[model samples]
Target: MPDIVDDKSEQCIRFLLDCLDAHRKQHAGDDAPPPPFFLGLNGVQGSGKSTLVSLLKNKLESEPHNLSTAILSIDDFYLPHSAQQALAASHPQNPLVQHRGQPSTHDISLLKSTFNSLKTRHPVALPCYDKSAFAGQGDRTPETTWTRVNGPDQRSIDIIIFEGWCVGFRSLSAVQLESKWSAAVGANMKPAYAGRLGKLELESVTLVNEALRQYDEVTDMLDAFVLIDAEDTQYVYAWRLEQEAALRRERGSGMTDEQVVSFVNGYYPAYELYTEALRRGIFPGVEGRQLVFELGKDRRVKDVKKI
Candidate 1:
């Protein structure tokens, strides 16, 4: 990937900087330093979130708006290798839990503890998950290898970029889930529509939905949010294919086209079930706090709006 600052980064930073300014003003009268501004960035796989994150960190930490920033990724919170294997065994009938892409595959307690510790301005060791471990099934890297922030030698963090593919997903009620699932089945049966949800069993989807409820606690902590929206969700397949193609060319080893499709299949169910709800808006009633970047199939911005 080329190092470029395009419309996505510019619009994202503009909105986030405004939110940071407001965040500082809220603590202007306080005697102590304000806690880090927690911003949630949600996007689908291969949506350039990682690239955008790099640009955001560089801009926030440099120039006149000098501020310390720390990144906390949801990917880093995945369960340990052994625990993930156990989960897969227990839920053998449920393909959603047979892999690590879904909600239940995470160590939520560790994530919550880390979030609470960061709020207190204490030294915190950020978790790291190594995706290459176990032949790409992934595993939590040893704690000794984790990154420590807010230590005496490091500058105090002023911003926390909490980013993930599912950062702002909200759980649905049973009635709502049934309704959505029914609609998906109906739509997919038609020749005009090709949908992923209908390919999944309701029981399998429910298992993931129930596990998602626990994530609401983390969502409540976010001060603001940014969503990189795709015009056609199916575009994710192409985007991911492009990424793997680049990887294979650069390193001479990567997932084959078939493997890439299988990997994305594990994730597309959640995208089908929850992403529309997110697109409607995650920060309801809190106007001007959530920014959305809508992109076309070409991966260029079509519009930037506050939802």
Candidate 2:
């Protein structure tokens, strides 16, 4: 994995150190700064946000300062597995919220509390969701098993790497939402894809935007946002397929290629709806430096630019 970061990790870590220095300055007053500077990393599925963050975390802990850092994945904040079943049942008419990939499925309240505890220097048992559990239906690890931050041996975190597919996503305005569906009409696109879900695609687009409104509570904490962008959306399917293949090889059980395609399709809507805003820096709560990594179809770094 060192080979993976050889190209850009140094520059990335240097940028991180600069952010930390500024953070230290901002908190030089009566109130001490929170131990960790918050960083949000965003990318579509299979776009390597996790890998980039891991590399980033390693460097943050290896410096002359040897900063202690922690990571939180938005996926781990997914609503309880049972709650997922209930959500799907309640929203039978809207398939987008019927599954976990869409924006509305997370328990933002839980995430909010966990993030707050960390920010306030309170003890927290960070929740972990096991996607491999429940016969692959997935479930959250019980509280008993959570890694307790602020434990006797654990150090207070000096950096938080908040990463996810939709980390920096902000909802569009009412008019903007209307314009999307309206534009679809003008482009000879239907308001909704026809199928069992019927208007769910259209309805869910609106639903996701509504859910994103609450996301600012989390994203506002970010002092920096990093984007791991695929060269084209088409790379999503191939990358996801590759991931599924690896999973199968390891466990001898996992989604087939056809299943992988379907799963990735569930997330396709948000990627289509949101990536442009990210590129434009229109997301609210995006402050400090923004970093963009453009990855080629083969998943190699094509370019790294700081904005």
Candidate 3:
């Protein structure tokens, strides 16, 4: 968590602070403290989001800003090990539901309740998920170990940063789903763009799409959004490979290149299916609050668009 500000971090800080300024202006006359500004951040896996979050939080919590920021990851709201196993058991035939990477694997009720609690601006323990638990299958860390914030005695939270690979994903209608699926099926046959969506059954993808609808309950709460888009979604595989290679270098053991490919394959279908919808825009009728960073295969920003 070094307080380092690189070019990307500088751009993000500018966007986020502008958002904060707008939020404060909106509540200029209010007596009660403005509710914690909710910011939704979405990035493709292995896109350096975690590093960006750390840098952004540091900037907000120190020096001139001195804002109390609480970080929450959608990954922390994932189903516990037992629940995830049960999900896989129930949806034995649906490969998407058989793991924790897709929409249906999250604990939607818990997420909703957490958001509700944050809105109250009261003491709440942020949920934590241990991805290393149960030999990397993952589980929720115990409540006692979770971080507590916004208490009467503690610094009141001013901003809540909710980030995840699929934070602001919107659900699709049946027609849209079918159109995307059919197009992906055609694309999959060719070697030009190798993606995972066409390999999954339409019924399986539909189940995930329906589950995504539940996430809108949380998405609507976001006051602002940041989308870290990639020019090629397939770059995720190479990015993840580099991540695991670094992990193995430091930890002596980690997923191999083949396992990394398999793991990413599990989540690639959602990227293929929904990333376009996000690129088009997640917040319609509301402008100036959303920021999109289009990144090349090298993970450098190619363009910045404010929507």
Candidate 4:
């Protein structure tokens, strides 16, 4: 594949094209073949996965091959707020469950079942998770999930780009907290659960680890993986803050900036772990990791590393 750093917009397009070609070659002999091409773009918040996928889609649309493509965001799989609230009610001390983007916050089984069905050319319904409301909305949910409809003349879906913050991490065994008080170290602590803080801490770690493991498993199902490395955690932190602010503003909410910061901070430890793991060569499957695209202080792509 072409280098992701040199003209990322173009390189991402070329990568998609190459993936499509590879998929065709891989199942050349099969008459009723299943969908074979899938790509996973894993990165932290504000790491440019969405932008890269958009560029790829535009590039493919302009091509002459008539290739059908779709971008599936893992964010859409987040559990509804009602479900999360139920979990929080039962495990009152575990703050991680209260946060929306953590591992346990998603409907993993549904995601797996949908992807599995899509792989076999079956239609699958995909839920649309709303980040602003921290829930799933009805109208936005995919009614007839994109399927690989094969025909002699019409082109089937040539590439499916699955991108998300925690796409490639796998779930580990659950880690139970020793006490609830220990869990209140992070922000967004409620007084009601202060007594069981130690238990919360253990549950939070367990939740974080399990989320990472689930991400890894999701990525494992992809044919290829890409990581958009930010300049540093600080860059991502700024971007996330801006995003959350914009979201609150658009929603016409009365939440103050401090509240937003606090909520965002609650996720810092979890995201930091993800960033550190990627930086430390913990994710071994990314083909060519590109760090710091043109978006921040040190915006130029600097290194080309293999995972």
lDDT (Cα, tens digit) per residue for candidate 1, span 3-84:
2224577677789889888988999999987788999999888878898888889888898779888999999999999999
In candidate 1, residue 167 scores what lDDT?
93
lDDT of each: 0.87, 0.77, 0.88, 0.58
Instruction: Give the runs in model 4 whose Cα sits over 4 Å from its true position.
Output: 1-7, 29-31, 134-155, 171-200, 211-216, 244-256, 279-298
What is the C-alpha lDDT profile of model 4 across 1-307, one tens digit per residue?
1113334666555555665567677788888764756777776665556667887777776657555676788778777666767766876776766556667777778788767755765554446654545232212234454332434454556567788876655443333222222444443355553222223355466656755655555566677656677665556556565666676777775446676556555565555444544554434644433232333333456654444
Off by over 4 Å in 1: 2-5
Quote each prediction's TM-score: 0.96, 0.89, 0.95, 0.72
Query: Candidate 2 overall Cα lDDT vs. reference?
Result: 0.77
* Model 2 CA lDDT for position 65: 62
The residue pairs in collision within model 3 are none
Candidate closer to the true structure by TM-score (higher is better), 3 or 4? 3
Global Cα lDDT for candidate 1:
0.87
Q: Is candidate 3 or candidate 4 better by lDDT?
A: 3
| Candidate 2, superposed: residue stretches over 4 Å from native | 1-7, 31-35, 185-200, 282-288
